[model samples]
Target: MDVPALNQTSASLTLFCLPYAGGSAAVYRDWQTRLPGWVRLKALHIPGRGVRYEMPPMHGWPELLDLLVEDVQSSVSQPFAIFGHSMGALVGIELAHAIRSRYGHAPIWFGASACKAPGSRERKLDWLSCPEEEFFDQMRVLNGMPEELLQNREFMELVLPILRADFHLCGSYELRDREPLECPMLVLGGSQDLEIARSSESLSAWARETRAPLERRELDAGHFFINTHRDTVISLVADSLARAFHSRGSGVLPSRSYA
Candidate 1:
């Protein structure tokens, strides 16, 4: 696995970003203005997307996590935070676990957006093996895939495989017994996210994955609210990083109780 550096080196804490299914590192290219001077943004480019198009994407958790964990170990030398959206949110959890297990340390902050909390028994549709026409229809309904890509035969021919591989990875995921992290977590949801509202009890459920305090926010947009409410999302992230910095020195986190 090749880890692409999204921004130049900085002494600030690195905020590693993992993108949603069918997303590339480029999704976060415009975040520089939103991030604070003390935070450096790094976006991970998974295989089968962007510059890694030639490499086949892995569908299983064990193999994909191993490669990603190794990448994180080798690439991250500074204190870091992990942020992920949709499928990437699940990646963030396992990545944080692997980091803690190997280095005896975890991220300063971890944020997951637009994803169902792990262990929710909500059955996701099998977009991977579904008929091509039906799968395309599902993509249309989800509003994740762009119309331009779907309309272009050559582009769809290229991206559909990657999308299917990512969807398969998400659909095949199963929860395992893993120790929770002590790092603070932020859970973001869009107000109109029917999938999240229908699948999980609430964002509070993310609390189960971490021992430290978890902050929850629901934006006024849909599942892709990160784009619609980018500034607010960035502000929340900045606040989390600030709290983590202060807490690191004081050895205390802000008090909060989750349901």
Candidate 2:
């Protein structure tokens, strides 16, 4: 259909991206032009934000994962990789597992940015109930959202529900699959992020999730490092895609153990 966030092309592989909480499909729409022409871009637009703003927000993973899996199953008929940032990282991991379980194949590569390994993170969703002022401050420090917008009452009012639902989506999540994914994985964190991924050690914990090769990287920015460090993220994705795709293949799914 008329999906603006998805760029369907005659590329060798598709990279499906999930955004951090409060982020939508628009987050990766700009990456299409920067990425090598061989990889297609399909940033799944979650309902109730950005392009699908009219749909009600999803409050938890069961529904969200259903949507994610269904969307990917429909669009990704060929080999593909998955990447997610922050809250998106958590969702992406689950999405990968769900896709693998139901479809019997895993992504060729998976990348998770600015998120701690699942089940190892400190419980921080308490901020979900904090006062608006406190929530604003926390989100400001965590995601680097514009201070003016965070401080603006009207703006916050309009976006707060969506943000809260997004937070719930990540906060209420419990990783179901304990076995490491068979697909190669890349885990990334921000060196300066004091909130979620505070240190390289935290990011490194992701190694336990994948039986295949896993790489970890820390950038020199804050939580939303991807925004400022787009080139590096894009480059990394391209490199991984190349390494995994091996130059001339289509319609292949990486062999992986599921469930």
Candidate 3:
């Protein structure tokens, strides 16, 4: 399949961001202004959310990846990077594998935020079988759902299914062993994210799967660190992209030596 048409400007790097489950492209709306002139930012909007609300949400992983790979390959052409949070992180990693296998182009850098390392234990929660109120409470703990929606029955009717489906997809993922990726992996976690382990050391396992460098940074926020620490998160990502751009040209992608 042909890749989607890329929107290009003069920027030296293009970043394709994937949002967390139940999130839309709008989640990264302000990122363009925050990034340096050398970098261009674009967000991939999955169906059943945002403007594509008419389309059904994708439940199968392979189908979802195919659609994303087609769209992303069409939409970007410059030296590019990817940043995915939570469910998006898994998507980003799988997309990396797809791009390499199909197009032979690898992202210069990959930012996997708020996700366990590939092949890590999957946390299972049967939200579908739980009471509606109980399921909402779990979402509240994650800090993404707005208070107004939780109280409004009409709004809950529309959003709850999408949320449940997303949670199910994430919780049910099965990891198959594969060769290490040949690109840099930047793993970021929030200090207070209850779902992820407290120690940043667990993130280092991601290094074993990449030939390029591995870097880990912990933010002093919870699961939604992107929202809670926007400035800090953006700055760190910008700096890493700049460094990756420079390193790519120098023919020295940093070594993945665990600290």
- TM per candidate comes to 0.86, 0.86, 0.85
Per-candidate local distance difference test: 0.77, 0.76, 0.76
Query: Clash totals for all models, in order?
Result: 0, 0, 5
Give one digit per residue, the lDDT tens place, for model 3 in 8-83: 2423666889989888889899988877665668788787899788878776678888888888886445577899
Measured with C-alpha atoms, the lDDT of residue 249 in candidate 2 is: 47
- lDDT for position 110 in model 3: 91
The order by descending lDDT is 1, 3, 2
lDDT of 3 at 73: 85
Question: What's the CA error at residue 162 for candidate 1, in Å?
Answer: 0.6
Candidate 2's TM-score: 0.86
Clashing pairs in 2: none
- Candidate 3, superposed: residue stretches over 4 Å from native: 1-11, 75-78, 123-129, 146-148, 198-202, 250-259
Evaluation by lDDT, superior candidate among 1 and 2 = 1
Residue-level lDDT tens digits of model 2 in 1-259: 1211212243356789999888888889789887866677899988788878998888867788887788889755577889999988888888888887788777888899988888676554654576788777778679668788877888888788888888776666665645678778888877789875454466777888888788777789888888999988888776666666652344443211111
